[model samples]
Target: MSSNTILSLVTPTISSPGVGSGLDVNGIITKLMAIESIPMRNLQKQQSGLQNEISALGQLTSSLSTFQTAMQGLTTAQLQA
Candidate 1:
C-alpha cells in the first residue's frame, strides 16, 4: 500500500461538533473511539504477522526434523549394507 493510505489509516479526521442541544453525543463519542482504536488495529496487525511468522517457523522445524529422521534411516540402511 502507499504511504498516504497507511498515514490515513493511522490518522483520524475530526469534524466540528454539532451546533445544538439535539446533537448526537453518542455518535460523536463513537467516532472519537473509532479514531482512538487505530493503535489497537495496528497492534492487532502486528500480532497477526507475528503469529504467521511463528507458524512458518514451526513448519520449518517440523520439516527439518523429518529430514533428520530420514537421513538417520538412510545411514542405518547403509551401515547394514
Candidate 2:
C-alpha cells in the first residue's frame, strides 16, 4: 500500500467528538446524569417503602375482619344457649 493512503487510513476521523474542544463531554454527561438521577433514586426507595406499608395495612385489615367474624359466631352461640 502507498504511504499516503496508509496514513489516511490510520488517522482519526473529523467527525469524532472532543476533536477541537478537548473536553471529555461524554464523561461529563455521564457524571451529570448520575447527579441528576439522585432524586429519582430517592423517590424509588420511598415508593418501595410505601408499598411495604400498604401491604402491612392490608394484612391488618384482613386479620381484623377474621376476628370480627369469629366474634359474631361466638355471640350467636351464646344467644342460643
Candidate 3:
C-alpha cells in the first residue's frame, strides 16, 4: 500500500479598521470608555466627600466632648460655692 501527502500553505490576513470606513474608531472608543467610567468616577468623588464629612463630624464630636468635660468641672465648682 502507498500513501500520498499533500502540503497547503495559508496566508493570514490582517484587517485595519477605519481605513476606508472614514470613521474615527479609536477616538470614538476612547470617548466611549471615558463615558462608561463616569459613574465610577462620580461614585469615587461621592465617597471622598462622605469621608471628609465623617472626618469633620469626628472632629466636632471630639471638640464637643472636651467642652462637656470642662463645663462639668465648672458646674461642680459652682455647686460647692
Candidate 4:
C-alpha cells in the first residue's frame, strides 16, 4: 500500500463542532439527563412515602401491643378479686 493512502486512513480530519456531527451532542445529553431524572425523582418520592407508612404502622403496632398488655393486667387483677 502507498504511504499517502496509509496516512489518509490514519489521519483524522477536524471539522466544526456540530457541522460533520449533525446532532447537538451537548444539548441532546442535557435533554436526556433531564428526562432520566424524572423517574429518579418519582422513585425517591415513593420511597419517602413508603418509609413514612412503615413508621406509622410500627407506631400503631406498638400502641396496640401496649393496650393488650394493659388489658391482660386488668384481667389478672379482676380474677384475683
Lowest summed lDDT across 10 adjacent residues in model 1 is found at: 13-22
Clashes of 3: 0
The alpha-carbon root-mean-square deviation between model 4 and the true structure, to one decimal in Å, is 5.1
Residue-level lDDT of model 4, residues 34-73, one tens digit each, is 9989999999999999999999999999999999888877
| 1-81: candidate 3 lDDT, tens digit per residue | 223222223445567888888999889999999999999999999999999999999999999999989887786669788
Instruction: Give me the runs in candidate 1 sitting further than 4 Å from their true place.
Output: 1-20, 76-81
TM-score list, all predictions: 0.62, 0.63, 0.69, 0.58
Candidate 1 lDDT score relative to the true structure: 0.91
Backbone collisions counted per model:
0, 0, 0, 0
- In angstroms, how far off is 66's CA in candidate 3? 0.7
Q: Over the stretch 1-81, how does candidate 2's per-residue lDDT look in tens digits?
A: 999999999997778567577888888999999999999999999999999999999999999999988887786669788
Misplaced by over 4 Å in model 2 are 1-22, 76-81
lDDT for residue 40 in candidate 4, whole number 0-100 = 94
Judging by TM-score, tell me the better candidate of 3 and 4.
Answer: 3
Q: What is every candidate's alpha-carbon RMSD to the true fold?
A: 17.7, 6.1, 6.5, 5.1
| lDDT computed for candidate 4 | 0.91
TM-score of 4: 0.58
Which residue pairs in candidate 4 have backbone atoms (N, alpha carbon, C) closer than 3 angstroms, thus clashing? none
Best model per TM-score: 3
